[model samples]
Target: MTVLVVAAIAYLTLALILVYAIDNLVALFFPDAHSAMPLNFPTLEKMMAASRKYYRK
Candidate 1:
């Protein structure tokens, strides 16, 4: 049981690290692309940006 728990945690940690690295690499190569956001929410970044702009108070 302990071994299985440790293995699961290790697997998840490695997967998260891989995802973070891939995301960084994609951003580095495709600065203009929106691969991080889904197509249905095309303007998600813009909307978040606008919200942050207005919430600066």
Candidate 2:
């Protein structure tokens, strides 16, 4: 359990770093520069879209 917790934390940290690096790289290579938002993203819109698709009566 302890090992799993440590691994999850490390995994999350690495994933965030990789996302930043990739976002930077893409922006550097693309004509229109894209940047990560400096704030948290909410999943409610995505969740609602998915729910609507699957839950239509």
TM-score of each: 0.55, 0.51
Clashing residue pairs found in predicted model 1: none
Runs in model 2 deviating more than 4 A are 31-57
Writing each residue's lDDT as its tens digit, candidate 1 over 1-57 gives 999999999999999999999999998987975466564565877888899999995
Compute the lDDT of residue 57 as modeled in candidate 1: 58
Candidate No. with top TM-score: 1
Candidate 1: misplaced stretches above 4 Å? Answer: 33-57
For candidate 2, give the lDDT of residue 55.
95
Kindly list the per-residue Cα lDDT of model 2 for residues 1-57, writing each as its tens digit. 999999999999999999999999987888565455433356666768789999986
Q: Which 10-residue window in model 2 sums to the lowest lDDT?
A: 33-42
Q: Where does the lowest 10-residue lDDT sum fall in candidate 1?
A: 33-42
